[model samples]
Target chain A: MKKIVIITGVLTLTILVGYFFQHKNQRKLTLVEKSDFLQAFATEIGQLWRNADLEGDQLCKKALNVDDSYYQCHPDYFKCLIDKNLIDFRMKKKKVSLKISSSYKSIQRPTHIEYLFPLKVNGLYDLKLRLKDSCREVFLPQRYYPFLANQRDVTIEWDNFNKKVFVDRNLSRVWEVRQWATKVKNNIVLKKLKELPASDIAINLEIVEMQKYCSYQGKHILSAKVYDAMSLHPEDISSPEVKLFRAPYFPWSRKNTKTNIFKIQKKQDITLTEKQSENLCKRVYAKNCTSVPFQSYSSLSSTWMGARETLGGVMEYVTNTVHPKENIILSSKYYPWSSHVHRVGIRGYWDGEGRSMNNFDFGKYPIQVFPNSLDIGFRCMRFK
Target chain B: MIQVLLILFTFISCNQESWETSLQYDLSSINKVNFAKNYLNKGDLKNPPNTWLKLATFERVNKKKCLFYKTPYREKKGVLKIVESLAGKCSAFSKGRVYNDNFSAFRINYVSSTHAEKSNILEAIYSTGKEQLALDIPLINITSPKKYERYDNQLDFSLVPDVSFGEESNQLLLENGKVCHGVNSECQEVVGYKCDKCQNGVVEVVDYNCPQGGSKYCGPNKCGKKNQIACPRGYKILNTKLNSLCFEGSPAGFCEPGLRTYCNEKNILICL
Candidate 1:
């Protein structure tokens, strides 16, 4: 009787072990893993709810698609059932029963609102009502309206600037393109325009002035835009459209810019104090500079010259800085956007410590970066 | 196990992306830029006319802006103090071009700032006494110049004078004579210097700038030197004669009166 019982136990154990291995090989996500994903997604949605960017949709789609293939049949993650380049979404008020922890630790609520996404998990599709209303404002203060200057009816005043082109970047020479739009005979016309064939490509930038004894005027901002010419409306800017439109973009300075809104004339080495570099951001956005972090290397593309370094990760490049000098890199800590930092054995701080933990693989999705955080610095290049 | 998980979390959760590494360049399919017929074709993605770029290594201070660029010797140097008005369109344009790789040729045009705001039209600012057109270059070359020899960015256009001008009018009398008719007597005609090096060079003759009475320049190369030698008192200087006639005075030795003589056809003295 004992021998017969042992044989039966062995057969049952083998069957259970084989079943677990088959499920694991198929890359199925457990119920707990799915719950963790929803929790993290609720956090990103919190940020998306506040920031009013012209291209805010890109962020929403990026957060959902990042590290998870919504296509090609992956069993471990939820798949965005839709197959389109752009992900169009809007928040809904409908409620459904879900087991989700509150996103906001401050406010307690009975039911959370439904969040719609173009994703499918198992037999589920269309919408996910499993979110906590845990949204809170980060450093960015919500400006009601930012006044934008898109109207060309105002007279263009005098400004002196030479339209000259040189590739902008460190250790690389890249071409610049600017498409100037003008209203002629009540029709849109582009002049001296050269645009690349790509999807919504632009570099966020800001321009500030440093005079010997003067407070300069004029708009100091440009954001990524589409189908419209850049306009200048000076001061009194407080419209949501203006805030989105007036965000500074760096590539615009290098391209075919018509209006000379600001000019930086220096007869010597320009050194801005830490307070001044902070002010540079204030002048452009008209907001507290702390809202925007330094910069992100993930925004690059395959077009750049040093394709290897740009893709491999600039954090690695920053660690190996013999070119830009540590002080120039720390100019943001000072104002006038100048002032050099003497490297006396201080390499500064890292975002999340661990020198060897960076990933060199930049697949289809770009690495996410928050502009308002640390790793704040600028890059200077020698032209080819 | 807990310590291992903590280390992994720190390593994977890297944040703070940077713009210092974001590439700022345009990309085109790997094909040589088309410069057919030595002109920037409209569709050519590589090089186009009026492509302007400004690159500067910079630093800033209290109400002070400084810019640095490569010096003439190719060393980086700072030489600009940027003072600016509130941000707006940079309408004040100043277009200039170097003649060639030698950097020998230049045509600069400065748009009138005040007028640009009102006229909505950009016109070159030219004053009467200032240089409007350069001479020593051909009219055709200046009016419709050739592109730079080696570089394509060098634009080809004449320097627009600060003001616009109408076509040449025939109403003005030429030195050949306004009308050499019998009725027109002593018709004063204005003779203009036909500049051999025209267009890229200029020449203007103000009657006020000309010498009056007694001394006169006769050849293309005038005013050989300052003329200090003058006829003595009571003597008149006459230049129409083959040699200068210093009348009312003795000719150093002997000569006839009225049909005065000092030297003949071969520079030999003869009495008439």
Candidate 2:
């Protein structure tokens, strides 16, 4: 019995010792294998970067040397340049910057940076990003990187988080991306836009110089949103393309020349038979009116032909032709028609849709209609 | 003769009891061997002698509490018996002895502090590492002490996925690919892509396409073809080897200056 007990104890101790030794050795081997793989990985990539630049079979030779596996793994490295973004390419020395303002009285200063190529200017880039605020106030999209991307009209998004450093992720969902695609690269246009009041969002490209009121042809035309113009068409213009129009007048003859506004005859009110009001949903008319049919008064017209034309012809024509016994208002819409360097100029005609014909005389002013000019348009403003 | 036979039977029984106790528990980490003896005397833990091996498992009860146990050894059906609680104890390793049992395995059960009643049991029979074993212990059993469970746990460099080294390695290299911001050594042609009729001296640089109508344009090999250049987007040509005797008898289009189109190959040019 003693002999049997001693044998069992000896066997158990020997088995446990063998198991411990085996487990320790396995762990050591695994560590060694992992170390070898890591060292190889580092060495291969290091060698890949050593060759200044190689293409085709030459480049493949180096890649193959790194590891036939690496070349097999990434085939895109040696493909065509167009479809590929050339993410691993050289960059230019130039860079673009951005500036923005918020209605909350807080102004974000513009940031400047050096530029790189390929990514610097390709398709209109987007700086899609998100920033959390303690308060839940909704700020305008103007305060984001998308706006800056569109402002620069470049493929490079020089996006910075918390206003620190720029990072370019290939994010295209940002608002500025669409605008960047649509934007025309005009440094002068971008410069003029930055100088205007922050609320003026829409920028018009018809007018070359933006100020109080841009004069075209022999008449003066006020600034307006792109939608307000008669012949201004943003859809027709290709990306990175800007067309300039010049008026045929004085020093102001080419004021909005670079712009694409067209002249159209203003609409006059019809002496409607009450039947036309209740029966016809939309009246087809030959003339264009400043106000809609059911409105009590004609809305403000963005068309201006110098101070003389506004006080003399446009004001008088609206009073006599549409409303003759109401007050009038003129104001500019916020932002330019396009995202270019331009001013906001909209004129409002308030409650002036009735009779005041005999009070104001027309013989005291010189009147003229701009026919060949294609840079004139009008918008309506309402009265409280 | 009857008295001698009785003494031999008593000695044999005592030897069996001693062997069973030794196989059942090591009791090394447990300070009081007398306490283990008392537990055995109390019939809480028992061991039968002449067994090949007995499986012992450890269970950690709560953050500071754990238990070690001994069990009958069956190939896959060994049950553990609690030997001692390891909570509030030192981090000394517990070693198990393989008794006469042919198949024996170690298992660990840990009860988190947040969950006193629930305990997580992890078996070490088929697992290779402790991490895998911990994972096998279901998340439902790993009662997190605090309400917040942060995932800020960095990737374990040791257990990095094999796929990461293969696919992500190239991605990392590309992302970290440094640009030679110098001039002359770095020259990039503008508007050099897909210009069928090269305008403004912007020649229709061949974009690494197949010269043969049927063959597709493979990577970076645009050699010995008229107007053939490195694919615009695929590669940027830099540091030209203008006139070298390295390729004396090569075709006019083959290995020419600014046209050694070998895709992604590395070399220290010996401009002989």
Candidate 3:
């Protein structure tokens, strides 16, 4: 009886132990299979964005549009997901539950829709807004005007420095016979013929007498001598030097014959002296016309109201003087032959082949100018 | 006599129990042994033995805990066993003979007590004593460009997924073919999917066929053809080399013949 009881107890204990291990192994295998299924599901979810035809659906289209605010909780969007078989949805009473089921045993895991469909709507909206902002045209004020029009217009009166009594009524049509006589080379014979009664001959001889002292053979006649001869003999009008101090003609110049000289001379021949420009500005515009300050000449538009030529205009005299004998002058425009002494009317103002506002040498060397220098002109500034 | 027989039978059954049940109640012991197995599998030791072994935990001696384990051998005497000390030396204990047919396939000299709790005993055992076996799949998390949030232009648009695992000792899986692991993983296969635009001409549509392409829907802008209009939104001029006028952000260009075209991330156009 004792042996049988011992055997029975031993057999039952062995069976129990064997069953426990078998059950444990089976549970472990099931856990491993469940883990593998979850892993596979996770991998599929990761690739679902690229694989699923979310673009084809109507609900997804509205949600993805950056302009539309439909991405935030649309019932149709969840319904679309259900229709596509991507997720399983349950609605009990007012509560909604979303689950993602795996292929193994239809085991489902509760899922957040946000993680599954992370639409980049906000990012797209931001990108669109930035792109629109980038395309906007920003207005920059016109910092520099290359060519500004003249502000005000005024008539200039001629300074008949050489006062002469002429028998010809047409002062406007009077040919500058004195300029021609000075160029004749043999003026000694013409001086002898001055006492004759012929009016043409007397006019020629008188003009010759005024210019003969002003001429120098192969030497530059300083503008001071011309000014001195005219200022000393203001009534002597036959001195051809009257053209040297004349106001320049602009396209907008008044066509009045009495105030302007409608002569057939080169446009460059029409110029004003430094002193003449200042005096004319004061007399004609009735304002203190000072030369643009040497320091502020380049940026004259900031303070002064006037148009300046950018490429080709007359050079103007400034008030700043480098030496007792030399004064500063500014040429706002570019001149191709700026270095030519005859054309510039001043020596050493420009030194290169072409002088532009950008490449112009400022105050490299001071310029020597008489009060009535003929090559440069000046504009009158009326203070605002 | 019957009571004596019952007590003796109980003692014998307990002593003859399997290793699985022996360590089942002691989870810490099971974890320690599993950690040692992982440490050995990670190539910390050279020529590690492959045979199964049984674990035996020793009481704390001299303020140090130790684990002793031995594999079955054909010889009865002089069976070698490994003693792993926790935070101390295991050389003080005298070697003893322990004969067990069922044993765990793991061996280690030392295992820190702190690391024992972190090891997944189930995963270690599931790998079934195989060398270089992948234990757990890494959990993926998308950290940037939060859902419904705009991407900053200042930061690069990174498509790389972040992967994380609980065990620090587990080796990271290599990405090849369909499965991508981390930032360094590359997808060699190109998807042939094309995206279409809506009738409004502004919004991009991912569908191949526009569902709203009826009279109400204006067709997509015709681009990449000679004398055609500029490319629509989300489509960039592909033949930029041939058409120098086509530049980034500039909506001018006609695609030249036999040149490739490309669409932005939205896949609004097909590159042909």
Candidate 2 chain A worst ten-residue window by lDDT = A134-143
lDDT scores of the candidates, listed in order = 0.21, 0.22, 0.25
Model 2's CAPRI class is incorrect
Per-prediction DockQ scores? 0.01, 0.01, 0.01
Q: Report chain B TM per candidate.
A: 0.13, 0.18, 0.25
Contacts from the true interface found in each model, as a fraction, amount to 0.00, 0.00, 0.00
Per lDDT, the best of the predicted structures is 3
RMSD to the true structure for each prediction, in A, is: 36.5, 29.2, 38.3
Q: Write the per-residue lDDT of candidate 1 for residues A329-376, one digit (tens) a residue.
A: 121222221111111111222332222214122222222442342222
- lDDT per residue, candidate 2, B1-272, as tens digits? 33544564454444332212332222211211111232221321224422222222222222222233334433333333233334434221343222223223333332234341222222223232233322122212111212211111111111111111110001111111122111121233222222111111111122221211011111212223333432121111111233321232222112223345332222111111
Interface RMSD of each: 32.8, 27.2, 32.5
Candidate 3 residue runs with Cα over 4 Å from true position = A1-14, A21-33, A49-60, A64-84, A87-384, B1-272
Q: Candidate 3 at A372: error in angstroms? A: 64
